[model samples]
Target: MILNGITVGIILILIGLYGMIAKKHVFKIIFGLIIISTGLVLFFVSVGYVDTGAAPIVSGDTTYVDPLPHTLMLTTIVVEVCTTTLALVLALKIYEKYKTLDISTLEDL
Candidate 1:
C-alpha cells in the first residue's frame, strides 16, 4: 500500500510537471503546481508510514510510525496553501490587467 501511494504520488508529480511546462494558460500552470505540491505531501507521508505500526504515542514493543513526516507534512500543507493563495491572487490581478490568462497573450502585451 505504501509503495502504491508512492508510485501514485510520483505519477502525479510527473503529470503536474508536464502540465506546467506544456500548458499555456496561467490557471493550468497554477493547477499543475498545486498537483506537484500534493504529490510531494503524499510521497512524504507514505515514506514514513509503517504498515504494522501503531501511533507514535503508543507504548509497547510494537513498531511505531514516525511522527516527523507527519509534522513536516503539516508544515508543507500550510506553506502550500499560502503559496497557492498568493499565486492565485497574482494570477487574478494579471487577468484583470490583461483580460486573458494565456501566457503567450500576456507576453505580447
Candidate 2:
C-alpha cells in the first residue's frame, strides 16, 4: 500500500483517459492528453529512480540511476509540447469555424 510516483502517474493516466472519453469539450480532451503525457513523464522518471544513487560519471562501484529513461522522458516532453501546441491550434480553428468547443456540437456539422 505504498504511494509512489509510478502509482500516481498511473492514476493520472487513467483519469486523463476517462476525461478524454467522457468529456465533450475539445479543450477538456486536450487537457486530458496533456495529463496523460505528464503521467508518462512521471512514470519514466520514477522508473529511473535509485536510492543513494550517484551521477552516471563514476569510477568506483556505485549505484547510478539509468540515464536512458530520463533522456527519453525529456524527448517525450518536447514532443508533448509540440503536440499540445498543434492540438490547441486545431481546437482554436475548430472554435473559429463553429463557435463552439463541444465535440458533440461539432459532430452534428
Candidate 3:
C-alpha cells in the first residue's frame, strides 16, 4: 500500500513535469506547477504514514504518522500556492505588456 502510494505520487509528479515542458502557455505552466505541488504533497504525506497510527498531537495514545514530514509538506503547500500565484501574476503582466501570451514573440523585448 505504501509502495503503491509512492508509485502513484511519482507518476503524478512526472506527469506534471511533462505538462510543464509540453505547454507553452504560461497559465498552463502555473497549473502544471500546482499539479506538481499536489504530487509532492502526496509523496510527503505518504512518507509520513505508518502501518497503523494516529496523528501526532500534544496528547495522544496511539502511534502516529511522522509529523515532521507532514509539517514540512504543509509548509511546502503554502509555498506552492504562493509560487502559482506569482506565476499567474507574472503571466498576466507579460500578457499586458506584449498584448499576447505567446513566448515565441517575447524575443523582441
Superposition TM-score, candidate 2 onto the true structure = 0.90
lDDT per residue (tens digit) for residues 1-108 in model 3: 456767778888998999898877777777788888888888888888788777788565778778998889889989998888888889888988888876656765
What RMSD does each model have against the real structure?
1.7, 1.6, 2.1
RMSD in Å for candidate 3, one decimal? Answer: 2.1
Candidate 2 least-lDDT 10 residues: 50-59
User: Candidate 3 at residue 88, lDDT?
Assistant: 87
User: Which clashing pairs does model 2 show?
Assistant: none
Give me the displacement of residue 59 in model 1, in angstroms. Answer: 3.7
Tell how far residue 74 is off in model 2, in angstroms. 1.0
Where is model 1 more than 4 Å wrong at Cα? 1-3
Q: Count of backbone clashes for each model?
A: 0, 0, 0
Candidate 3 residue spans exceeding 4 A from truth: 1-3, 58-60, 107-109
| Prediction 1 global C-alpha lDDT | 0.91
- The Cα error of candidate 3 at residue 90, in Å, is 0.7
Tens digits of lDDT, candidate 1, 1-109: 3558789889899999999999999999999999999999888887888998888897768999888998999999999899989999999999889899999888889
